[model samples]
Target chain A: MDDILLMLPGPTTVHPRVLNAMSQAVVNHRSKRYGEILTETNELMSKMFQTENQSYLITGSGTAVMEAGISNVLNAGEKVLNVVGGKFGERFKKIADAHGIKTQELAVEWGTAVTPEQIKEALDADESIKAVSVVHNETSTGVAAPIKEIGKVMKNYDALYIVDTVSSLCGDEVDVDKYNIDVCVTGSQKCIAAPPGMAAITYSDDAWAACENVDSHTFYLDMKAYRKSGNKDPAETPYTPSVSLTYAMNEALKMIDEEGLDKRVARHHKAANATVAAAKALGLELFADEKVSSATVTALKIPEGLTDSDFRGTIRDEFGVELAGGQDHLKGNVFRIGHMGNISYKELFQTFAAMGIYLERNGIVEDGAAGVSSLVKSYL
Target chain B: MDDILLMLPGPTTVHPRVLNAMSQAVVNHRSKRYGEILTETNELMSKMFQTENQSYLITGSGTAVMEAGISNVLNAGEKVLNVVGGKFGERFKKIADAHGIKTQELAVEWGTAVTPEQIKEALDADESIKAVSVVHNETSTGVAAPIKEIGKVMKNYDALYIVDTVSSLCGDEVDVDKYNIDVCVTGSQKCIAAPPGMAAITYSDDAWAACENVDSHTFYLDMKAYRKSGNKDPAETPYTPSVSLTYAMNEALKMIDEEGLDKRVARHHKAANATVAAAKALGLELFADEKVSSATVTALKIPEGLTDSDFRGTIRDEFGVELAGGQDHLKGNVFRIGHMGNISYKELFQTFAAMGIYLERNGIVEDGAAGVSSLVKSYL
Candidate 1:
């Protein structure tokens, strides 16, 4: 089978260099050479997080680090304010609940961003709340929360701020220190343009302080263990890491360095803008609020009378383009176009060209070229 | 640096086919195509485990699944029998302690295997023990536990049998059902010859029954979630998996299928026999008892005058052969040669040749060719 162009929320199209990096021989994780690579990678990751806090690389997916962020700092029965807006947002509460941590959920409408006022109100009502957890970009809804604003409100309280930027981070604006984030997590397969199976977390001094008070129940995801191993002579993870994935991550991060984070983020923004414009040109309504739509992904409502299978299946099988359908409650109602990582204008053009042809052939739109024209205009 | 031949216990030299498989484009984890791949991979994994019990793939290292096996089936304060002989063996106890589980440690000397009699005595003494955790292969000490014997003893007890074959499965004899293993865990980077960052766990009906009674504290390593997602229409992981690694694992498993498990185990045994014979020919003392030595890794004591740096460093820098040093208290005292995965007589010849040259150059052995001659003879 020919390679399908990945336009999903994550597991983005990897660069050839990154894929080639993974093809190298596996290295001993405890060796000095691997240690040097790990140290360099962590340094680059710290820079990407825009924080002085130490960053930890985990050998699991984004959810693993997310669980690490919560379970390490907060013990069972401790109150935490979880902002629930989309699938990813609800995950924080699920993780908290799984650990037996008491969650004070601040529910927000799907496809809408959580407001700082709501967070403040919840925190005000619960003086015992130890943390406020939010997702920077909700891939399921294509909505980016106002984390910076929420961080400001959190600064006034004793609650630590935990943020999940699994789908944003390098693809959008994220200043960890400036946003007062105590614990921030990101995944490798998203904006990093690396393969999945690895994730990273940045922990502030406050988070570490909280960790000292809480008796962590986790062994593998323990942040203190990571910090201890990471502080060794050459640095290391507590356990064996995915060695090949680390190589891929190092190469991908180097690519990000070469491209410059500012330029990379701008490219994601441009692609998102092009996708949104093209959807509008096709007379399609977006699933997310325009003001809060994500810079890394765009969610468009499926055209009236068109099934998700009709839209995504044709784009994938017939056009050789893989687009993500909506998740959870939004399934069949919305379709997402991921424009993060190494995606470029060329890929964007092809995606719209396929969508336009499909819509026009299906009689959903009069002009098959309308979406492509809007995409081209945005690039210009 | 040129490619260093990996002869470590894990992260061994991967076949070009497996490495090339990882270079494929990333796919959406929730898509049908990915689900089919996942389902096929799990089926292959179950066969490798030699069990009818369902196998679940996790996006973390072997340690993560080890934690899953313990945490999911046993609750806090539940008594468990932890068999500790080496670094990896002690890890099970640590994980149990981290989760607030009451552990009755059956301590065995390092460089030695735990006898079935010892386990039977411990379980006889403690009727409240909910589980027995043991490592099949102690990589740190190059000791392979008598799990089949232990299983016979465990059959008379109510304790769930948890075995960690992180470095043993595929490279040695492992019959999960025959051994009565309730929960069996193995790593991808070890015998499977895949990249790190993924692990598999097989759960029996008794293990699932135990899980139902316990309130699991973990979120990411929650076995129930994996079981539910894996039982889906097309089968899926609870969270996003390392897509490229999954591809690599699938290809590696296919290679295993082609080679056949019986031949693969025989090959490992041959390589191990050759390594042990060569070590003896070089006048090196085996670290672990010869009777209980691992078929995948052979540990040998360093010569009287040669420093670990002088031995391993020269072998690595001058000869480009990478071997593993001892862990914990055995550091610098022992060196291990991994003969697992897709290792062949060619790689083994190069490794022994390097060792022979280094030993003779250091005046540690009278005849430089003695070790290499033994290796060649064994292969012949």
Candidate 2:
């Protein structure tokens, strides 16, 4: 069998160089050598986030950030508005609610995107909301929510505007400072092309103030403590940072900067376009509206007689391609094709070709030509 | 300057093989290939831990396990008794206290051990204490506490016995399954001779049950959740496991098991004795009582007119021997020589010779003869 391609939203196919970085034995997190690595890495991460405010390098998955965001900022009965559109969006509410924070949720349809208008409506309706949180790119629905639009609306409100850029940060243009995004958090595995472990977070003074005012219940992710420790020296993390991932991300971020964030995002856009085009040529419906569809992932409605898991399993087991099945409520109906991180058009073509072959072998399609042709035509 | 030897408690000098293992580029975490690695790793880690309890790998440092240990088992107001002697002991208390667990601390002097009698007194004094915690080898003062004695004493009581074996496990023998120890935890960077990001922990059914009953505040390090997630399938984790550290640990554990656990501990003991022998031959004073001194890190009092940091730093800067200076209340007063993890006899002698060179350079010794001679005689 051929090597499998990961087309999932996260824990995405890592660049070989990134994995090579993880393989090195762990280093002393406190050594001057590690300190230099941490110091320089923080500087580079600041450049990537386009923020002057200090940041933290956390050692957990993207969802860990949602927990940290709430545990750091919100106290019990403190009001926070969570935008609910996809699975990740609901995660914001779940985490906040679990923390006993009073939460107001702006709900959207499963396949639809949450708009700035929706965010405005939610905020205007709730004067008690201390923070407005939303996903920049909802991986589950394959929709890039209007972060800039929401940011514009949120600028008028006193509430801090926090965004989950986990699937979007390096996959697209997220000028964190320009957006006035108080808290912008992302994971390592997606657009950075590193493996899962670390979550990179940049926060504004207002966000820090909120986190600080709320006394710590959060351990392992006490952002304020991390800020205090890293402040002494950016090389010093409050807890044991994942040194290997820090090393891998150091390299991955460099690769991103060398390629230029613009070109990287453009590549992601091209791959998503090719994926959508190939799906269209195969006569499959897109789960998300094109206007709001994510440039990093494409959620497709499972074709007739095909279940989401079955389609993904065949892609993995037979064609050596891996696609993400829709999660939670949308399960069994849609499968997603991820195009972010170190991925390229060339890889997308291979993924689509694999998909086509799997469909043909499973008697789900008459021939493999249509899907592969469309992906090639997308490049042409 | 020569390539410095790291004689600090941890992160000890990493093995080149382990470093090379970590340099392998990222692999998709959810891939069958990586899953195979986890499956093998899970089995190997279980063996290293001397447990049938499945391995639940976290991406953070050893303190991560302390936080996870408490958060998994302690609810708000649940009581804990900590046998505090050194840094790691205090660390365990801080972690528990941070979680709002009611704690009774049995504070031993800085350079002394925590006896089972004192632990029982603390336990007898506080019936509300659900867990009695101790650091097996206090990294701070080179004191090896009596976990076995404490475990034996605690057998008469109902509270779970949780031991922090971070600096001692693998390098020192820990009969985790033998001592009615409910929770036994260690770090990879210590005696395990692996990288720093992972923590290895074992739990008895009693401790697992306690974790289940507690209303834990954490999402990331909740041991019950980790156990449940791993129990879903033999090869699963609740969150993104550190694949790179997992790989390095897999290799490190194989090395330890091959060397034989008893022999590995014996090797460490011999090396430690050699370091102490060399220190004594040079007319240096050992900080801890000889009886309870750790077989990993040996703390020594700085000679008159020679401050600890200056002495250790000179060794690191000139001779490439990285000995550790004291922390907290003991700062600048003592230095430690670590015989933990991937270090050796030649390495030990080299460090001793450096110390002698420094002493001679400082006019304390006539020449480097004492350092070289003492270490050589010990080896002979």
Task: For each candidate, report its DockQ versus the true two-chain complex.
Answer: 0.79, 0.49
lDDT of 2 by residue, A76-179 (tens): 79998888889888888877776678888888887678888878888788798999888989999999988887788988998998889998988877888888
Fnat by candidate, in order? 0.87, 0.51
B190, model 1: CA deviation in Å? 1.1
The window of 10 residues in a row where model 1 chain A has the poorest summed lDDT is: A1-10
Instruction: Give per-model TM-scores.
Output: 0.98, 0.95
Q: State residue B177's C-alpha deviation in candidate 1, in Å.
A: 0.9
lDDT of 2 by residue, B2-55 (tens): 155678898777777776666554456656667777777767776766776665
Q: Which stretches in model 1 have alpha-carbon errors above 4 Å?
A: none
Q: Write the per-residue lDDT of candidate 1 for residues A1-380, one digit (tens) a residue.
A: 33799998888888889998888888889899889989989989999999998888998889999999999999889988898999988999999999889998888899899999998888888799999999999999999999989889989999999999999989999999999999999999999989888999999999999999988779999888999999997999999898888898899999999999999999998888888898999898999999999999999999898999978998999899999988888889999999989898999889999998999999999998999899879988
Query: Lowest-scoring 10 consecutive residues by lDDT in candidate 2 chain B?
Result: B229-238
DockQ, 0 to 1 scale, candidate 2: 0.49
Q: Count backbone overlaps in model 1.
A: 0
